[model samples]
Target: MCACKAASVTIVDGLKAAETKEKCPLCREARVYEGALHMEELNILLSRRCPEYWGERLQHERIERIRQAKEHWDSVCRAFMGV
Candidate 1:
């Protein structure tokens, strides 16, 4: 499976060509047939469905969780020092 974030387009003989591209047909159809709001929603949904997007989101969440834990620990240590 290709792990590209966006559809890879290439110029060949003055024409655009997609290279190793995969997308949800429903999403593409929605973007073409639906309004701006619907297109935006479909785009968000598609991005979330992508593995790279999910991986990045999970990594960010993990980093945030670690940061929050460290903050909580520091606060606890400060409280203990004052006691």
Candidate 2:
């Protein structure tokens, strides 16, 4: 079995402990969350052997951007019509 022998690092932002983020054990990659809480750490490590990890992440980011843009446009229209 494959495993990352390196220790996990935690990054704290200013005095906000809640904003702390953890880097991946393998490549030191980090995301918005503190750790790989969205998925199993074992699965995340295994996914490094495939390309589906980045593909899924990119698709998620694209969908998030579209959702945010839609919300922004809706708010703008609401303000423009004075309603």
Task: Flag regions of model 1 displaced more than 4 Å.
Answer: 1-48
| Per-residue lDDT of model 1, residues 1-83, tens digit only | 12112233221111123332344344643222222235346547867689797678657656755766687789899999994
lDDT of 2: 0.48
**TM-score for model 1?**
0.41
Candidates in order: C-alpha RMSD to true structure: 16.6, 11.9
Model 2, C-alpha of 75: deviation from truth (Å): 0.2
lDDT of 2 at 62: 67
* Top-scoring candidate (lDDT): 2
lDDT of 1: 0.46
Model 1: worst 10 consecutive residues (lDDT sum)? 9-18
